[model samples]
Target: MEVSKNAYYLVNDVLRAAKLYKLPSLAQLCRERLFSASPSSLFGGGVEALAGLEEIAEQDEKFSDKNSEDDPHKQVEIPGGSARTLNDDMKFALSDEVWADTVLIAEGHRIPVHRCMLVARSEYFRAVLAFRRSSTHLTTEAQVSNAMAVVNVEDSYAGIVRVLRFIYYDQVVLPSLNRKDAKGDSDGVEQEAERAEGAVNDYLAEEASDQLLEDLVAADKYRLERMKRLCEHAICVTVANCLEVLAVAELVHAAHLKQVAMRFVQTHLAQITAREEEFRRFQKDFPPLLEELYASLRDASREEFLLRIVH
Candidate 1:
């Protein structure tokens, strides 16, 4: 079905829902319309419209180093405690309840937050915290007081915290793998160290991978594009999380992440397919994704076969 004129502005929203509901034709139509739209219109115009300009700037020498010396961005200097100090101060404020004007409740955790910070950082939160004026001419103190104080979020506490941390400091901090001492005698010290290292690696490979998956989903849900990119890069480096990452990338429409995950899957197809449980899980939980992977594999094989025939 085609997108109606009344719903033209909601094509992106319809696309996401169509994908979720497995409506390929609707999704494809929405994608065609969305892709046809100019980047400025797609991204709400202004600075956001210039999102990919840096890539063009890098390739065009006229826009590059020759003019860097006179660039206003390069001329500015941090006079005081450095940008890190400012970030740290903001992070500290995330936990400081005294100055907080709002609260975000997630997974039974009550997180104090500032309305100004929320308004500045997220469009979702801005709408949530926006005051409703009863009349066009006037808004009373009581109407202003109707602004959100406690917002209940459906995301996990960790996910909410991670998103808030990114909002506060513009950083994605993954959970660190801690080194635990393996039980052993002094004579077995070398072996113990190796065991400890291996154990830590295994635990992090599983646990950290899961955490990154959750964080990426949260980042996408909150429209934190930069955080999602950071998560995508971090997720790409892991073999253990590739499948789940692929699933998430597709679900969230993270094109870069999906491409990277597809490459990872292609390279590790043998190893991944060997795991019957995981293969079965993919078939059950993500049938469409599994079908696409097989189709991709077949297409790759056909191209390779044709190239060999020519050679």
Candidate 2:
């Protein structure tokens, strides 16, 4: 279908404004078009114009891809492949290399790629450093806030680092089993020790407790499972002694806690019964939250929570 002239003019006007204003991404244009523009007013530039714009964008992307092939900045040569388009694997590898450089720039660190061999001996530590170093590349407050929220919610240094790397570099670091020569027993032990050392270093290098909490919240929103698990584990392990964390944990893991609430009530019956006032206060304050949590869990799973009162 053809776009009407009036609609085309409006779309062009918006696009021109967007280009002139130097917005970092097309998201703002999309938001303005979808939310601010009236449906009737946008009729001329409606579906057809939008489709045409998308087609143009795709063509531009292809043209850029073609130009990149001849771009001097990307002058890597492949054997017997002068005419062929770059494969996905090659593109991914190049992207990773570029992201690694970007991470260094963001982190305010200056370790050259060659020197990275020794510095990156510990993958986990390297990932953490990259996260702290590259967060600046996010460039927008919303992006920064979202990333921070993910990190806070996940509550694991490793998990937070992984998400940050994905956000900043579009790469996921997967764990793999490494096979070493069975004969090199001493070297294997030394390597293992180094790994342990790196883990300790990362733990020590982590941000403050408050910052970690914020990161855990962010991680949960971003659906970084590993980070979420780590955060939960950390709360149960390291911060369990803290009453504030214990309360927050109850709110966060309410459904899981409810599943085992009977057991918990029985085990801590003395504490609950003895501190009736406190328990009553907690129930009153978090009743809706607890109910919502239980309802969600019951809906997802076929388990209902039954409570009994004993006089």
On the 0 to 100 scale, the lDDT of residue 271 in model 1 is: 86
Q: Model 2, range 1-311, lDDT digits (tens) per residue? A: 23544554555555444434433234245446545644444444678657655764575456557556655343344447532232434344433544243222223323212214313333443455457547567787576534421111223545445455544334444443233323325988878877877665445434333344444455455545455455554433222122233355564553342344434443454565566566566567777644654465465444332332321
lDDT of 2 at 23: 32
Q: For residues 61-136, could you state the per-residue lDDT of candidate 1 as single tens digits? A: 4433544644445322333633225665687799898877788999888999988888788877877656323322
- The CA lDDT of each predicted structure is 0.74, 0.45
**Lowest lDDT 10-residue stretch of candidate 2:** 146-155
Minimum summed lDDT over a 10-residue window in model 1 is located at 75-84
**Superposed model 2: Cα runs more than 4 Å off:** 1-215, 237-262, 272-280, 288-311
> Residue 17 in model 2: shift from native, Å?
45
Q: Name the top TM-score candidate.
A: 1
